[model samples]
Target chain A: MGVSIFGLAWRSLMNRKVSAFLTIFAIALSVALFLGVEKARNAAKDGFDNTISGTELIVGAPSGQINLLLYSVFRLGNATAEISWPTYEAIAARNDVAWAVPISLGDNHRGYRVLGTTQSYFEHYKYGQRQSLAFAEGEMFDDLFDAVIGSEVAKQLGYEVETPLIITHGLGAGGLTDHDNRPFRVVGVLRPTGTPVDQTIHVSLEAITAIHVGWETGARNPLADNIPEETIRGFNLTPRTVTAVFIGLKNRATVLRTRRDLNTNMTEPLLAIIPGQALAELWQVMSTAERVLLAVSAFVIAVGLVSILTSILTSLNERRREMSILRATGARPSHIMTLLIAEAAVLGFMGAVLGAILIQIIFAVAAPILSAQYGVALMGTGPGLVDAYTIGAVTLAALFLGIWPAITALRRSLADGLTVKV
Target chain B: MTQPIVSLSDLSFAWPGQPPVLDVKAFELNRGERLFLRGPSGSGKSTLLGLIAGVLEANSGAVHVLDQDLTELSGGQRDRVRADHLGVIFQMFNLVPYLSVVQNVVLPCRFSKRRLGEVQAAGGAEAEAKRLLARLGLSDEGLLSRNVTELSVGQQQRVAAARALIGNPALIIADEPTSALDADSRDRFIQLLSDEAQKTDAALLFVSHDGALAPLFDRAIDLAEINHAASIMEQA
Candidate 1:
C-alpha cells in the first residue's frame, strides 16, 4: 500500500514536471543561500576566536584594548606608544616567563605588514594553541638580511626564495625614511595559518635596525650616508624601543596574576590583555551583526518554505479530479493527505541535501580567493555541527510550511469526492 | 424474493439557500437487479447517486445499503461502508489520469479491507483486476500498465466499468458513465457493465439521460417523477 501510494505520488509529480521542477529549484536555491551564509558566518567566528589562542598575554605601552589586540596580535594598526627594549628584556628575564617575543612595527612590504621580531617568535609564538609555524617551501630566516614571508605575501607578490624585496619605513603609501637603500632577500615561506600571520613579512630585529642605520633620530642625516657599513654598525644600533611584546606564561594559571601586575606595577604606562578575553569581547561587539545575518538567512528560508506551500496549495485545485479518482479507488481522505505530506517532506529533504552540497561547491570555488585576500583558509569537508543545525532547522521549517497544503488538499479532496459523479 | 441491496426512504437534500434538489419517497434495488434511472440535465441524478453511495446525508429518513443504515453510521464508517459495498463510476472523469488502467481498477480494494479480501479471495487482486480488464475487452498489453490519460474515451469508460465490478461489491452506481462515448461505444459500455454486474451478482444503478438505453435494464424509473422536489421546483 505504501509502495503504491509512493508510486502514485511520484507519477503525479512527474506528470507536472515543469511545475514540480520549479518548486524544487526554488527550494534548492534558497537552501544553498541559507547554508552558504551560515557556513561563512561560523567560519569567520571560528577563525576570529582561534586568532591568538597560543599566546597568553599581549604587552604594549598603554593603549586601548582593541589597539593592543590589533597591533600585538594581528600587526594591523601602529602602536600609540613604544615600550622600551629594556622593559621587554626585563619582562623576558622573569622566572614566570616561559618565552617572550618582542615585535618592532612601523614597516610595510608592499601591502603586507612587516614585523621585526627575535628568532623566539619562530620558535615559541603560536596562534591556535601550540600551533608552531610550518614552512611550506623554505626554512626560517638564517641571516639578519634574510626575510621569512607569509603564505599570502609569497603568493600575492610572486615572491620565492632569493626574491629581493625592499621595505618601507611607514605604514601608509608615502612616509619619511622610505628605507629604499637596503633590500631584504626572501629566505622562507610559512604555511597557510588562516590568520593575520599568513599575510605578514617577518624579519629579524637586527635587520630592522640595519635598514634604519643611516637615519639619525627618525630623520635622514647627510653625514650618515658616507659612513662605511662597519663604521655605522659601531654606533649604537640597538633598538631603543619596541612596539609590543607577546608573553607566554610558564603556567596557564599565572596569566591573570601577571596581567594584574603589569597593569599596576609597571613604571611605564602599559596594558597587558589576555588574547582570548580580548577576542571574546570583540566577538561580543560583533555578535549583533552576526545575529542580523542569521535572521536574514532564516527569512530567506522562510520565503522558500512559503513558496513551496504556495505552489502545492495552488496545484491542489488542479489535482481535485486526480484526488477524487483516488478516493473512488479505495483511498481514504487521510491516505491522500499522507501522500501529499510525504511528497512535501521529500522535497524538503532533497533541498537540504542540495544546500549542503552547494556550500561545499562555494568553498571549492572561493577558498583560494579567501586565502589570498583575507588569509582565511577554508576547508571543504562534510557538514559540521553548525551546518547540520541549519539543515535540520530549515527542513523542519519546510515541513511546517507544508502542513497547510496537505490539510488543504485533504479538505478539498473530500469535497470533490462528494461532488464527483463517480 | 431476494433482499433489497439498496433502500431509500423519504430522502430529501438541497443545496444551501435553495429548495430541495431531490426527494425520494421510496426507492429499492433487489440483489443482482440492474436498474436504469433516467433524468434530464440538472434533474439531481448525481445527487441521487450521492445519497445512495452515502456520499450525501439525506435531510429526512434513511438511506440503507446492504441493510446498513448510512445515516446512523459515523462519517468515517459511512465511507467504509461505501468502500466495502458500493462502487461508483462517473461519466467524464472516472479514472485518475496519472494511474495506470490496472491501478485504477484495483483502487476500490485499497479503501476497504472487505473489498480487498473479496478480490483476493477469488484470486489475487491483481489477477482479478487483469481478468476484469480482459473481460471488458482491454488487451493484456493495455491492462498491464498504461496511463488512463492515454486511453480513448471509449477505452476509459470500459476501464471505469471494470473498476466498478472488481471487488464484487453489493451495489454499483454509474453516473452517466457513457455520456462521453459514441452510440456504439455507449451500447458496448452498458453491455460490459451489465455483464460484469451479473458476473459479480451485484445490483447496478445506472443513471443516464438517454431514454433509448432504458430497455436494457431490469427496471426503469424516470428521476423527474421519483424526485418530488424537482417537479415542485419546475411547477413553481
Candidate 2:
C-alpha cells in the first residue's frame, strides 16, 4: 500500500517534470547557501579562537586589549607603544616564565610586515595548541642577515632562498626605507599556518638593531657607510625597545599571579591579557558584523522558502483535476496532504546534503588561497556539530514552509470532491 | 426481484439560491438490475447520482443503498460505503492521468480493506485487475503499465469501466459515461458496461440523455416526469 502511494507520487512528480525540477533546483540552491553560511560562521569562530593558541599571556605597553591581541597574534596592526628591552628581560627572567619571545615591529617588505624576534619565536610560539612551526622548504633563520619568510610572502613576492630583500621602516608600502644599504638574504620559509604569520617576514632581534646602527643623531652617518659590514658588526646591536612579548608559563597555576604582578609592580605601564580572554573580547566587539551576516543569510533562505511556497500554491489550480481524480480513487484529504509534505521533506533533505558537499568542495579548492590571503584555513573534513545543526535547522524550516501548501492541497481536494466537476 | 439494493424516499435537493433540482417520491434499484435514468441537462440527473453515491447529502428525505440509510451514516461511514460497496465512473476525467491503467483500476482497493480483501480473495488483486482489463478488450501488452493519458478517449472509457467494475461492488454509478464517445464507441461502451455489470451481478444505474442507449437496460425512467416537485419548483 505504501509502495503504491509512493509510486503515485513518483508518477505525479514526473508528469509535471518542469515544475518539479524547478522546485528541486530552488531547494538545492537554498540549501547550498544556508550550509555555506553556517560553515563560514563556524570557521570564522574557529579561526578567531585559535589565533593565539598555546600562549598563556601577551604583555605589551598599555593599550586597548583588542589592539594588543590583533598585533601580538594576528599581526594586523602595530603596537602604539613599545616596552623597553629591560621590561622584556624582567618578564623573561621571572621564575614562573617558561619561555618568552620578544617581538620588534615597525618594518615592512613591500606591503608584508617584517617581525624581529629570537629563535624561540619559531620554536616555542604556537598558534594552535602545541602546534610548532613547520618549514615547508629551507631551514629557519640561522644568521643575523638571513631571514625566514612566511608562506604568503614567498608565494606573492616570488622569493626563493638566497633572494635579497630590503626592509622599510614602517607598516605599509609607503613606509620610509631603512635597510636600503644592507639587504637580508632569505634563508627558509615556513609552511602555511592559516594565520597572519603566513604573511610576515621574520628576522632576529640583532638584525633589527643592526639595520638601524648606521643612523647617527637621527640622520645617516657617512662614516658608517664607508665601514665594512664586518667592522660595523663589532658595535653593540642589541634592541633597546620591542613591540610586545609572548609569555608561556612553566605551570598553568601561576599565570594569574604573574599577570597581577606585571600590572602592579612593572616599572613601565604595561598590560597583560590572557590570549583566550582577549580573543573573546575581540569576538564580542565584532559580533555585530557576524549578526548582520547571519541575518542576511537567513533572510535569503526565507526568500527561497517563499518561492517554493508560491510555486506550489500557484500550481494547485492547474492540478484541480488531478486532485479530483485522487479523491475519486478513494484517497482521503490527509493522504493528499501527506504526499505533498513528503515531497517537500525529501527535497529539503536532498538539498541540504548536496549543499554541504558543495561547501566542502569549495573549501578544498580555496584552502591554499585562503591560507595565503586571509590567513583563515578552511578544512575539507566532514561536518562538525555546527554544520550539522545548520543543515537540520534549514530542513526543518523548509518542511515548515511546505505545510501551508500541503494544507491548501488538502482543502482544495476536499472541496473538489463535493463539486464533482473537473 | 430481490430486496432493492438502493431506495430513495421523498428525496429533494436544490442548489443554493436556486430553484429545486430534484424532488422524487420514490426510486428503487434492485440487486443485479440494469436501469437507465434518462434526463436532459439541468433536470437533476447528475444531482440524483451524487446523492446516491453520498458525494452530496440530500437536503430532505433519505437515500438508502445496500440496506443502510446514507443520511444516517456519518460522513466517514458514507465514504467507507462508497469505497466498499459502490463504484462511480464520471463522464470524463475518470482516471488519474498520471497513473498506469492497472493502477487506476486498483485505486478502489487502496481505499477500502473490504474491496482489497475481495480482490485478493479472487485469485489476488493484480490477477483480478488484469483479468477484468482483458475482458474489457484492453491489450495485455500495454494495459498493465501504460499511462492512462496515452490511450485514446475510447480506450480510456473502457479502462474506466473496468475500474468501476473491479472488486465486484454491489452497485455501480456511471454518470453519462459514454457521452464523450462517438455513436459506435458509445454502443460498444454500453454493451461492455452491461456485460461486465452482469458478471459482477451488481445493480447498475446508468444515466444519460441519449435515448438510443435506453434499450440496453432492463428498465428505463425519465427523471423529469418522475420528479413532480422539481417541475413545480421550476414553475414557482
Candidate 3:
C-alpha cells in the first residue's frame, strides 16, 4: 500500500519460490543459448574475414574461383592442376607485382597439411590486421631437410626445435605413405594466428620435388630404392611445378589489368581470385542458415516468456482471496494491476541478469575447445552495445508479458472486490 | 453538528441478469455510533456493504459515506474515498499470508495516504500498528514477528481489527468477522473491536447473522425489518 508495488510483488513471488525459480531458470538457459550462437557465428565469420591481409589475389590453375581461393588460402580442397614453376616465375617477375609467394601441397605430417614455400613466404605473409608472422622459437627453415611447423602442429605433436618428423607421401593411410627415410628437422614453430595457417607444416619449395624423386615407385620400406638425401639434394633440387601462388600487386590500382595479363598473357592457363570477394560469396551461402539458427534461438526466448505468462495466469485463481483482501484494505483495481505486473517484471529482469551470467560462463568453457578445433577465436569484449540491447529487449519483453496477468488481476478486483467466494 | 458517517437513501442494486439484491429506503449511522445489522448469508448483507464501500454502483439512488455521494464520484475517486475513510475486516482468512503480524496490522495505511499521515505523529505506521496490536491483546514479541497465517484465529481477528482501526478512518466495517471464532472468543473479539472503535471515535458497522452477539452494540436492526428487497427475495 504505502510501500512500493514492486516490493509487494516481490513478497508475493517469495511466497511461491519453486515456480518463480523455474521461470527465471527457463529464461536464463534460452538467453545463454541465443547469445552463444551469435558469438560462435560472429567468431567464425571474423576468422574467415581476418585470415588474409595485405594480399589482393590468389593465383592457381585454371579452375573455379572458389576452388582456387579455398585451396590456395584455406587449404580446404585439392587443386585441379598444378601451376608450372616457369609460370610462377613469370608472375613473380612482373613489373606490377610487388612480391609473390609460391606454395606446393601434396603431403601431410600426421593430419596437418605440409606446405612447401620459400623464405619469402614467411616475410610477405600477413594475417589479422596486417600482422606479420613471428616464430615462437628458433628461426626459419634454412636447409633442404628443415621444416617450420605452425603453432597448433607444434602444440598437438609436441615438436621441438630439433625434433625430426617424417612427412606422409599424401593424404594416405597411416604407415603406408610415411616418408620415414626422409624425416625433416623442425627448425622453427610459428605463433598462433587463429587461422588455417596455424595448422600447417612449412618446408622449402625445392624439398617437395626432392622428396618425390624416385618415390613414385611406392617403395615398401623407407630405405628401399630411395636415393640418399645428399645425392638428391645435389641432383637438381629445382621444382618443376607448384600447387598455387599468392600474388601481391605492386599497386592495387593495377589489380584488374594484372589479373587480365595473367589470364591472357601467361603461357599456361591460370585463374586468379580476390580472397575478400570469395569470402563474401561464402557468407551469402551461409547467411540463410545462420539466420534460421538465430530465429530458432529467439523463439526459445519467446517460449521462456510464455512460461512466465502461463505461471502468472495459473496463479490468478489461487490469489483471488488475496486480491479481495487487498481490495478490502483499500487497494484500488489499478493497485492490484500494478502489483501483478511488478511481479512478472522482476522475474523477467532476474532472468536476463542470470542469462548474462550464464553466457559468460559458457564462453569461458567453450573458448579453448573452439579455437583448437576450428581456429575461430572468440574475443570476449565484455558487455558491449549488443549485450545492452539484448538485455533491454528481454526486460521490455518481460514487461509486456507481465501485462496479461496484470489486466486479469485488475478485472477481478473490479468485478469481485468485496465478494470473493473464498 | 457532525454529519453521519454513512447514509443511504432510495438505493436499489442488482447483479447483471439477476433479480434485485438490495432495495433500501433509508439507512443512517451517526458519527461515533456502533450499529449492528443482522443479515445471514444470501441476505444481501454483502451487497449493501459493497455499495457503501463504493466497490459496486447502485442501480438507482445515492450511497453517501463520509458526507460524500459515492454515486457521483469516479471509480478512482471512490477508491480514494474508501481508502481515506473506511476499513473492513472479513470472517476468515483475515490476514494476508505473506505479511507478518505488524505488516498485516498496518495494511490500510499502505493504501490510504491520509491514514499514513494520521499515524506519522504516533511514530509512523509500524509503531502505531504495534500500539494498536498491544491494545488489542496481541503483544507477544514472537507472535508479532511470525507469519500472519501461522497465528491462531483469535489472534488473526485482533490483527484484522488493528488493521481496520490503524488509519483512524471515519467508518469501520466488520462483516461477519467473529463467526469463525469459538463462542467464548467471539464475544471477547467483538468486545475488543468495539473498544478499539470507541477509542478511535469511529462509527462501526458490525453485520452478522448471530443474534446472541447483538447486545454489545449501541444499536441493532434486523435486515428483514429494514431491507424490502430481502423480504421480496424471500417470497421468490
- Give the per-residue lDDT digits (tens) of candidate 1, residues A256-314: 89989887887787799988888888778878888887788778777777777877788
Q: Evaluate all candidate structures by whole-model CA lDDT and list the values in order.
A: 0.80, 0.80, 0.85
lDDT, model 2, position A179: 63
When only chain A is evaluated, what TM-score does every model earn? 0.90, 0.87, 0.93
For model 2 the TM-score comes to 0.87
lDDT of 1 at A404: 80
Ranking by DockQ: 3, 1, 2
Each candidate's DockQ: 0.41, 0.39, 0.60
Per-model TM-score versus the true fold? 0.88, 0.87, 0.94
Candidate 2 residue lDDT tens string, B1-236: 46899999998887667677788889999999999999887677877877887767778898999989998987677778888888888888777877778778888888888889888899877778788888888866755677777788888888888888888999988889898999988898889889999988998999998888889999999887678665644653
RMSD in angstroms between candidate 1 and the native structure over all alpha carbons: 3.5
Stretches of model 3 off by over 4 angstroms after superposition: A1-3, A172-174, A218-226, A380-382, B230-236
Docking class of 2: acceptable
Sorting all predicted structures by TM-score, with the top scorer first, yields 3, 1, 2
Query: lDDT for model 3, on a 0 to 1 scale?
Result: 0.85
